[model samples]
Target: MDYHTIRPHPDLSSIVKCYWTLEVPYQNDAQRQLIVPDGCIEMIFILGDDVKRFTSGDEYIIQPRDMVLGQITEPFYVLPSGDVKSFAVRFYPYGFSNFVSISIGDLVNKETPLVSLFGNEVATALADKIRSAADTLERIELVDAFLLERLITKPTVDGIVKRTIDAIFSTKGKVSINTIVNDDSSKRRQLERKFLKEVGVSPKQLGKMIRLQSALKMLLNNHTGSLTEIAYESDYYNQAHFIKDFREFTGTTPKAFLGDEGMILSSVFYKQD
Candidate 1:
């Protein structure tokens, strides 16, 4: 397994978090992989065989080669049909909304075809450019160019929403919404509504996801501490609080997630980052 992330062009850094690629050797029988939410959205382009996304225990749909995966609220499963090769654009929590007119909330927990966001012709041209690029670097250039074209008339991000998201990330989700809005009820409601439109999740939801991500990073990095310690480090009130949040996002206990074959992808992805 090989996973790597590259910084976006300096000009686009505010919107594009990074460009990431993952390549895993083929397995005759690929194990299902568990993917948990992390408070951001992604646009993925698969360059290998079709992968199956499990909607239920025994049902799944093959993911589109080029699609945008919206804000995920729960754990989902997927399995590779063969060797895995994928490249994706990871967007900041408040970034994607600038490119589309629709409310981001409508896209939660789903993979919508890129054509749905961009028109069919534009989507097809962009996908072709990405897929035919000679290498990852070339692909990045193409993607950057595509985004630049669309960003000519950059949509203004809500100032409060942007600041709130920044605070959540800077504190690893320890900051409360009240702190973010400074206890103004009107501001809080406004932020909530704007957050849904721009980030696809409420401020509280995004904070929880960010906090869980911190815990996951700790565990994956081999922190020599107990779950209780991880919980405190992540700002949870107690071990029970940590466990409850962990299971909510990952669909399993921390110990079980560590031992599960379904987490191979997440383990590698997080470890590399």
Candidate 2:
């Protein structure tokens, strides 16, 4: 298994978080891997075998070869059908809305094919170019060109939404929405409406996801003293609170998460980020 990430072009740095790739050899006994919410949307291209996203016990769906995976609110599982190879663009919380007219909230917790979002003709042609590109750099160039073209006329992200997201990140999600809006009920409601439309989640949900990502990096890197210490460091009220949030986002306890085989891919991602 191999996983890596590359920085996006400077022009796209604000909206695009990064470009990432993953490759894993085929294994008949491969286990289902847990994928947790990380507060980012992704544009993915599956260049290898199909992958199954489990919907319920022993039931699944084959993900599209080229798709946009929207904001996930809960943990889910995916298993590769064969050797895995993929290239993806990771977007900031408010980033994807700028490229499409559809409400981001409508895309939660599922994979929508690029054709569905970009239309058949344009999406098909773009996918063909990506598939035929010489290498990762060429693919990056192609996507950059495509996104740049769309950037010209697409609507900009809502200011309140972007600023709220910025506050969440700056404070490691510890800051309260009430404080951000100065306890203004009207402003808070307005923020919530815009967030759901443009960012695909409520301000509070995005905050918890961001906070969990911080805790995950600490847990993965072995940089914290103990669960209690980590909880406090991450601004949770107590260890139990930390564990609850951990389980909510990751579907596992912090201690169990450390050595879990299902977490290898997620571990690589958090550790690197």
Candidate 3:
């Protein structure tokens, strides 16, 4: 398996963190990969064989074509049916809402036809353009073009969500609702409702995930610190709190996570900023 990421068009940078691609040769031996929560949403287009998805014990197929998946709240797995190739976009917590009509939360852990959200012809055209591109750069460029020409621009959602995300991401999970709310009265509740509706997880959950991400990086970078020290550095309440959050996010203790082959992919995605 090979994975790479490219920067998104400036227009989408506010919500879309980056676009990524994964290519794996046809191999029956390679059982599909199961991806868990990373506190973000994504839109993926399969350029090769049909992508098989399983969630909530439900099996759905993403035709060897274009599809946009909503926020992922639970765990899911995908197996390559054949010469597996895919292009995916990683959207920041609230990024996807600007482009789709439905409340972003309604789409979490769900893969819906782009036609439903974006008209059928437009979705198909974009998918075809991406698939027909000669290379990743070309595909990325096509994606850039598609968004520029066809993506719906919502100023209100854009301003509110973007501001909130900026506060959290810039602070590296060291902020709270109060910080994001600024001086708006009832800002905490308003932000919470919007965040939960648009981003799937609450601001606090994303903050914890972000902090865990920072701590994992510090440890992996050989910062010469104990888990306790790293925990404090990461801004967890205490060592025990750190341990609990770490396990909750990663499904394993920090010590056990180190040098674990099964966790290699997750580690790469979660390690530090």
Candidate 4:
């Protein structure tokens, strides 16, 4: 697998984390890949072969060629039907809500066809442009133009929500929800309701996902840390707590994940990011 990310245009940087591409050769008996949550949404365009997302041990639906993957709260499995070539826009936690009118909560744990969000005519045109672009640079330019138009008409994110998200990422998710709320304890419930509507998960869930991402990155990149040390660095209470949370999202122990073939794509992603 080959994976890489590109910085977004300056104008879109606050909303878009980056643009990423992945290419993988096809094999007759390719193994399904594990996709862990990272507290962000993605607009994905599959340019090569179709991909399958499994909802059960033996069942899956073919993913739409162009779609938005909502904020994921749990890990899932996916495999390519053939050669895999994909381009995607990774949005910040609060970014995607600005693009469409539907509640982000409705999109959780599913691939929403772009047509449903943008309308068929507009979505078709955009997909065509992406498919016909001469290169990645041209594709980026096309997407940038599309988003600039949306940005003009869409409402801005709530000030509190934006700042809280920023703080979470800045602290690598070690910041507490009370701190995110700035001790305005009465607003916590209201904030969580709004957060679920716009971000597809509560602030607390996003924190856990981001914190796990930090530890996953550490484990993938450095081989020196003991599990306890990694747990500490990631701000967990202890090794047991870290492993428990990790398993909830990844469905496997950290030690097993590092060497699993299913983790190849995830490993490459963490290493590159």
* Tens-place lDDT digits, model 4, residues 154-214: 4489887887788889999899998767778788988888888889998899989999999
Error in Å for residue 201 of model 4: 0.8
For candidate 3, the TM-score is: 0.81
Backbone N/Cα/C clashes per model: 0, 0, 1, 0
Ranking of all candidate structures by their TM-score, best first: 2, 1, 4, 3
| Tens digits of per-residue lDDT for model 2, 63-147 | 9999999999888889999999999999999999989888999999999999999999999999999999999999999999999
Off by over 4 Å in 3: 26-36, 50-65, 81-83, 152-155, 158-160, 179-185, 222-224, 270-273
Q: Under the 3 Å rule for N, CA and C atoms, how many clashes does model 1 have? A: 0
Q: Please list the C-alpha lDDT of all candidates, in the order they appear.
A: 0.91, 0.92, 0.71, 0.91
Report the Cα lDDT for candidate 1: 0.91
- lDDT score, candidate 2, position 179: 93
Indicate the residue-level lDDT of 106 in model 2: 94
Q: Which consecutive 10 residues in model 2 have the weakest lDDT in total?
A: 153-162
Alpha-carbon lDDT of model 2 = 0.92
By the lDDT metric, which is better: model 2 or model 4? 2
Q: After superposition, how far is residue 43 of candidate 1 from its true place, in Å?
A: 0.8
Ranking by lDDT: 2, 1, 4, 3
Local accuracy of candidate 3 as per-residue lDDT tens digits, 46-144: 877876765446565654365666655444566667886888888878767666666777776677677777888988888778777899888888777
Candidate 2 has a TM-score of: 0.98
Residue by residue across 14-101, what tens digits does model 1's lDDT show? 9889999989899986799998888878999999989999998889999999999999999889999998999999999988887889
